[model samples]
Target: MGESVKYYVLLILRGMAMGAADVVPGVSGGTIAFITGIYEELLDSIRKIGPNTLKALLNEGIPGAWRQCNGAFLASIFGGIAISMVSFARMITWALENHPILVWSFFFGLVAASVVYIFRQLTSVSWREIMALAIGLGLAVFVSVARPVALPDYWWVVMLSGSVAICAMILPGISGSFILLLIGIYPVFIGAIESFNLPLIASFLLGCGVGLLAFSHVLSWLLKHYHNVTLALLTGFLMGSLNVIWPWKQILETTVDRHGEVIPLVQQNILPLTYESLIGLPSQLWPAIGVMFLGLFLVLGLEAISNNMSRCE
Candidate 1:
């Protein structure tokens, strides 16, 4: 009983980590799952809901297959994700609103440490891996710098964005929110959530539901046949995304909408760090850096516990 409760808590924590990553532009919930050793299991469990399970449900009824294949586990994990996303959305949104720079700084540190952790996990560093890493890095950088498109505020576009973004959501190197931002749907999608607009939200979710089923097949195949290569690529993807999430920057340009809200469309400059900035940092930056270190230590502690648990197993 105690062990079961402990695992449940761990899963909830994992879901929260996933939620945080999904909220960011360059990070991914899938990356969080991969680093935590739950990626393959998650893919497999989701894949079970295909034809075989459907047939079983129709023929033997829901209860039989549900019990035989452990539906409760899937329900528990996904339910946790759903709960975390909905519950944390407001709090995260508020944090981003009130403390954008500090929040980004903490995540910046998280990803920086994550890149190191992932690099250390690689068993071999061949020329192929090197090339792959460079390619991944370049691709991520390109995406980060590309100008956002002005997409139409149509329901169809919203659905398309949701489908594509959700597909990207599970890939560690790809940012789902960034995908939306690139497609010019980021503002509307975020607006829907912010305003509690039900129609737009429903359309987006329907598309995401469809995309998840389609994407899971590809993910499952990669896991089964090309696990190492996939992980390597994902690691490269995460490493490349560092450029997008880098914290220090200023809004060099700004515009206002009809509603009189200032929209900063382009960031004209990134404030590169100097020795003086670190040594004589302002109070806000210093506390943010400390929080960044705390985030790093949290991941390291989780890694240590995971290693110990693996040894016991």
Candidate 2:
């Protein structure tokens, strides 16, 4: 019993790490899962909750279906994610508001290390794989810099946003919330969460369910058949995502939110000295660099531990 409790607790901690990563704009929960050695398992579990599992529920009963779907594992991981999102939403928001540069610097380092880590997974490199990497890198860079579209507040739009965002959530270098922000529904979704808008939440969740089921199957298939190319592409994605998280930036455009607060909409990356000269901000160069190193080492340490455990097992 104690062993069971201990195992589940560890799962919860992994989920928490995922949740924290998801909260960051340029980070991905899937990155956490990958680092923690649960990426494939998580994908498999998600993929199982489809037609076969439903059929099992009807034919063999709840126990069989639950077992087939790995219900306990899913529950533990998702429960931790939910808890972390709810618990840290406001705190993360506050941190972003007050310490944007430092926050971005940390995630920037995290993703830079992630690119190297993911790249090492490739056993061989080919021209086609290199092309795939370029494509992925281009796509990520484009998405990172693309301007936000003003989406309507309609239910369908919200649902579509959720569907798309959840896909990004599961990708190693793409961020779901950042996708939402790009589509101009991030504030609305955040507001919905804060207000407990049941209908909006339901619609969004429905979209997420559909998206996750569909995307996981496609991803699982690709990983099974074309592992090298896929990893190459994902590594490229991490490489391009660095542009999104660069620490020093100048806001080129701003928009008024619902609260009438001016929020940065478009930004240009700049050197620390340039940022100081142009924006007249303190730049916080030393602190940001320190945090960046902390994030880099954190990923390295986790990778070392994961490797050690694999060897022991």
Candidate 3:
């Protein structure tokens, strides 16, 4: 592919990866983008739809905003995300249901690879940045470890759930679904999806849309002015997220909400582990290790191809 086309293609692939990550409860596509070094560009490009675009929309309408916002990039990346999520959602749901080990193995690989990719990008890390990374990682790990709970079922509760979940959706390392779970709304949102409850879904999407636009700009500004600090925090987030993706824990029973729908809860360390392990072999731990390596390698492989293409250009 030509250089421009190649770059756009990478963006789409990243979008797909993000879609896959977001499909799971703990992973964030934002984290994948951050690890792959496209997070800032992704945010900046999205943030291009600023005051001018709004003004134009007020005056000349959608077309003006379309032109001002570099609609092609948005169309491509978000389009990729939409396509991947819609197309793969069923398959992913099944895999998580039937073959949890193999599925999480792959994610383990993806995240491991992504961390390496991010680390490689950082030429030097100061203690301050390291501290930021640590903070991010710590927070992510905490989220991963928390127990899931029953959610509220009121309209106002739904609105609040939308706002909070949307924030996690935009931020790297956080899972929107998990955020819903934290707020005790996972079952509520899942019910909306299952029952095709349009009003409920619409309310949630409205919150997501508003949250996404607002958060994207704030993140864009942070990356613009405080690049290293932002990256550090994101790195911490990725590290912390490992707790959620660890593949062998057995789910305890489930809890039902006010609606009496059951949601699974988990307890940790159901499998054997040792310092020495191999790709999903000998035990579940090995597979998790292997998958983590695979994740890391995938990111590095893409980076290598990307860097070579830039050189050729």
CA lDDT, every model vs. true structure: 0.73, 0.87, 0.72
Of models 1 and 3, which has the larger TM-score? 1
Which residue pairs in candidate 1 collide?
A: none
Looking at model 2, residue 280 earns an lDDT score of: 95
Residues 1-313 of candidate 1 have per-residue lDDT tens digits of: 8877787777777877786678666677887776676777777777777778877888899896786455776666666666766676678778877776687777777777777777787778887678777777777777777876657767877887888998778887788988887776776776777688889988888888788878988988985786656666777787777777766555555655444767556653355454236435443667678878976886677678778766865
Candidate 1 vs 2: which has more TM-score: 2
10 residues in a row with least lDDT, candidate 3 = 273-282
Clashes per prediction?
Answer: 0, 0, 12
Error of 1 at 235 (Å): 1.5
Task: Sort every candidate by lDDT, greatest first.
Answer: 2, 1, 3
RMSD of every candidate to native, in Å, equals 3.3, 1.4, 4.0
TM-scores for all candidates: the values are 0.87, 0.96, 0.83
Compared with the true structure, what per-residue lDDT tens digits does model 3 show for residues 1-313? 5767877787787778776677677777776666555676677776787788899899988998887887767777777776676667777777887777767777767766666666656657899789989899989988877877655577766776777676676677687767777667766666676566778877876776667777888888887787778778877877777677777665565666676655567556445453124233345566656766777677677777667755765
Residue 49 C-alpha lDDT in model 1? 72
lDDT of candidate 2 over 1-313, digit per residue (tens): 8767876787888898898888777788988888777888899899999889999999999999999999999988988887887777788889999999999999998888888888888999999789989988998899999997768778889999889998999898888888988888888887777677888888888998899999999998888899999988888878888888898989999988777878779989999999999999999999999999999998899898778766865
User: Lowest summed lDDT over 10 consecutive residues: which window, candidate 1?
Assistant: 274-283
Best by TM-score: 2
